[model samples]
Target: QRATNVGYTALRASMSAAEWLTSEKSVEITVATTTLDGEGQGADCALKIHRLKQPAKAQRASLTGYQPYPVRRGRRVADEAPKPDPANPNSWELGEVVAQDGFNTDAAGKATRTYQLPPGPYRALLTTQDRFGKEVTALLPLTVLDPKGKTLPLKVPNLVAAPKWSLEPGEDFVALWGTGYDEGRAFIEIEHRGKLVQAFWTEPGATQQTVRQTVTEAMRGGFTVRTTMVRENRAYLTARQVGVPWSNKQLSVAWEHFVSKLEPGQKETWTAVVTGPDAKKAVTEMVAALYDKSLDAYLPHYWTGGFGVFRYDSSSLTSQFENVVKQLRHLHGNWFTDYRDAHMVYRSFPEEIMANLWGYQYFGGYPDGKAHGLLPGMAGPPGKDGAAGPRGDKGEVHDMEARVGGERSSMRAMEAPAATAATVAPVTPAQTPDLSQVSARKNLNETAFFFPHLVSDAEGKVKLEFTMPEALTQWKFLGFAHDRDLRAGLLTGDVVTAKDLMVQPNPPRFLREGDVLEFTVKVTNQSATAQKGTVRLT
Candidate 1:
């Protein structure tokens, strides 16, 4: 029984070795093309299989002394490699097999085949099963170029986006319209982080589209919008970053204070009107805001002066105000960001306040001369092509803004108005005086300075005596009559002052990066009597 078992095991081993030997068929496969062109005469591919060795004695043989093996040919494209389908295990989801040809072997056991295929890149595979049911595959890669070499690559499109309402405010709803030229289908994607926030597709021939998205504070961290144009198998991409939104509610407060200081009639009446520079349609939209009753008039220096003054009454005032806010919301994009900054400059340049007092003064009009309108360097509306200016003109829409005020003439300057409000001056530490010495007979006290009465002799010469209150550091002397305008020097030193002021920085040393420097400015009370006043730091 043991001898019989050993003989059976040897027989089983022999059978296994025979199966392995039969499966190891020595076949050499090589692929070639009849013509270099993507398209061929009859087909694009010619594959030759040379059977150098055949299976052992038990395999079937033909009388012609040739081996005919079953062979199958197919292709798998790069893009379709990831697709999966359980129904077709042998044919996993793949790009269509572009070509196939009859497989026939010659008398010398050489099989040659041909395949018809179009121009493109593909992975060609020749698969065959050995006598023992073992699979054998031969792979060949092919990249077919255009036969005529006339096909060209797709190019990136020229793209642009602009707001429908250029002056819209930060919180308002605004639509961004985009226009460009591309050959095929286009895609617009607004992305934040690695994920897509907004996406839209355009048809093959459509070059214009609009995207409406809220201008929000959260987007301040920077989100990007991208547009892609796809043609054939290629893609072109472009991206634009969203800008920070302006939030200036304080502008209303500053504007209110400015109107309050004007003369009674002037406060209610429009002093000047500005218009033109039609190239910038959005600038005209700002005219809607000028109707607010709180504002006197809109007179930008860059614009011509013949514009009609507008004032909103109780009936349309609220609507007009809302329109102004709405327009500002539309202007929340990058194009209008500089304009917002210009508004901030208007405040401080005025009294070292916050407004561009200089610009306002320039637009305010000539105090001595008649009001004359100024035209911008460029004339007429922008071109129909949505250009900011006529062809060949390097004109920027922003240049159409009012020029700096108070710069019309070298002589005109910003001047402090005469003391009309009767406000007391502040006191500085340099000239703090004794309050007990002040006389109450003249209404002079620790907090108030009193002016003394003066009498003119027969010669029209006058002599006066008054007490300078405590904290009085400096004073200006001026001569003025009831109706005549007074002209005086502007510089503090040039004007008549009671004392010489000295300004000194503490430590008397250069400031380092994080150092906080303190300043001590001193002024003497040059008057014979003590005076009450305060010092102003800038």
Candidate 2:
């Protein structure tokens, strides 16, 4: 039995060694040596070694791209590796190499290289060899911008005039006029709350251009006017309209009948209707002007008289004024008495307009002569009558009538109600919800998957089986492998496991028995074909 056991153990050991030699993914190297003893007897010594399996051939280079930084003209800018083409993510486009450098990695296998490149688009290509003698390449794209960066030469509009700062949406017209530079066409852009709301292009010229835009609800919060001089489809100059609060409000004026032509010594009555939420409380003003051909300007009708403007309080919504054309001649001589074209302008403002006026005066006026201030308050409709109050005491009412009749009244003492003991109910403390069973549905927050000792099969492939965590997210995988010979390689990738049709319920963390909640659930369909399903909540 002992002999048999020894033979069985030896045979099993030999079989295991043979399987290792044939099944293992490695190469065997053997060295044999012959030695001679003093007595001339020959002996043989054998050594066996294993080498790393042959590395796979270099199929294609793996490129790691980087985001390109904006390069400014006249400045030295560094380049980055080229990014993959959007059309073909596996390939990269080649470009001219304006700069180049060589670097050596440190103990951490990391290196940095700097290059000064000129302003233009560029691509950086890097090639490296792996431990297996396989060559891989990394590509990155680079871009250099002009020295101005996002800023262009500022070319302000010679004039940005609107008929009124406050306007009615869809009912009022806003006229904007601007002067453009000689080199390009004026591109007008209207932005409201940092968003472009309207934009248009003007005729190419170094002349004044005008556009009439109807106000819309989108412009109620005010807007900014930006003018850019575009030459050859490139913006060379740009500016924003400043010193004005271009907003809509609740105070406006409309002419009932405008009197544009007035003869000498003729008295004409001009009437305007004030309309808006605060029309009844707004202040209206009018100014008459006569155009002078010699000065090429319009002179105020009453330039030599009081204030040169008519003021009215439109408490009833209508403002009217009568002016005698001859009075202008009497005050300022024949220059105003000439047969010139006349014009009338009317404007209305809420109570807050005084504050804006004060600010304008305090700041000595703006360079653009446009007033800037807070929006005028919008007065709502008159409130409805409140409910009637309880009837007054009889004696108090009688005394009020006696006083109205001019008769002396006698004071009467009123009886007070009897006091009664108050009854109170005992208060009960709120009971905490039973949470012992609330945790029945276990929460799996541990999303990490680490297989430190994974063994690949003979074909150099690994199969992993696991139950994914209940979290909806992306998982990144990093793996490295090394053979007995110390030849190593690394790889990284991402995996996402999700249902084509999924229903995710977003419930509150905790809840009471009778609590009302707006339970919401997100349904996502990621399959190529559209599908419909019903959902029921228990």
Candidate 3:
């Protein structure tokens, strides 16, 4: 007997485990009792096992938080109308009844996948096979809505910048840099000449614009690789690629970017550390691989540094400057990413607390920063209870992370959702937790792909520069050695490269009857690609 209060997954008749436990098998049982029976005797127990009879049907799960899921059907045709012969991207062509899902045939030669439907008001039917080759048919219900409304529409996101992909001369390596190569609910797909190149997403909702894909020898010139981005839950879009030679200058070996403009007196030094030989983290491995000596870290992506909203003005700082800030902040002062800023400005606007909870430091005053022991400009962690009501601060946005060894990942990030109570067996694997792992900056690499010997200098050396409008070059204010050259070490240049980069289509952009939306792609290699040694196009 089991306690009724305990929760359990429902037992299903079709369960494979049922055949074993319910068969005439031997089962061992041991019971301990202090009570005796009839005529002054000891406790006794029986080793009894019973077969669980199969039920005629399985139980359905109760729906508690199920919301109105979006619905879609085959393009709806009015009673007086006739379905147009499929012509362009939006028109649902007479799908290959067998391969309509776009999924492939399994080993058993059967295609299967559930296709999405546009929200409401139509009816249709389809026959398809599950991956296991089991044939099945499903029905749809008809509801009334505007018959002329849009059907299932897909959109391609705008490319934030030109993608730069180049080959490591004489090596089978290619380094690509660009924006928006994330994965999950809202993900992006890289396609080359109307073909899928690769797909990536770090997490849901992070439309970041930096990714590197290792390619095989199968890659070649004359192919345009464009990023197709779409928000699975929302609608937002863009795509771009410029100057990719289809006939000549197919000779890119390395690619990178450097912001050419700097403020009056702000200085910076990039510190890079190759990942320790004994790194035990996946993030470390993946990030480190981006700078593999054989590959180039000259990525096509730029950090959205130099962008920030004014804390006091409460107004937007939406200029090229703001965009720069967003990129720089994303890199933080981390050794893992090739964060190069030639024109850094020194502003007295650090957060009062570090971005992490409990990280607080006092700076420039009677600064005995209390409560988490932080000063006025430390970052006090993000997503901190929205800093509402009493005892709150503005999301602690001003933290300083010196680039020494590794990137400091946010502790507050989206995680996999919890499973709700259910009777139906899960048809998919539960996602693994995406937790942040700490890393030291010195054990990572920032420019192995472009210049392996750039950081080959001696150790323990440091440098600092505090310039004024008059070009103040005094190191005493910051204190540092004289032999270090911060300029030669950073990844900076006026030009970058984009190989096999193309523009994806925008299908849902105000579609009317018989309209076509064109997606474009272009490729080019900047002069910077020539100075490097290794170059890979794959």
Candidate whose lDDT is highest: 2
- Estimate, for each residue in 1-538, the C-alpha lDDT of model 1 and write its tens digit: 3222222111110000010111123222333221122211121222322211111111111223333233434553333233222211222223565554445333232344434334333455654433344444455543322222222111113333343222223543333322222333557676655567678785435444545567554444445666665433334456565544232210110011112122111213211111112211111111111112111234311222222222111111111111111223554545534434434433324443332233323223343321222233433233345443322133222322234332233224245443322223665656665545533233212322222332223322222223333232222222111101111111111111122332232333344443333444454554467655544333
Local distance difference test, each candidate: 0.31, 0.37, 0.26
Residue 515, candidate 2: C-alpha displacement in angstroms = 5.6
* TM-score to true structure, per model: 0.19, 0.19, 0.15
By TM-score, is 2 or 3 better? 2
lDDT of 2 at 361: 39
- The list of candidate 3 runs beyond 4 A from truth reads 1-87, 99-457, 460-538
lDDT tens string, model 3, 245-359?
2211111111122222333233433333221113211111001111222223354443221112211111121112111112234545645667687997786544432433233
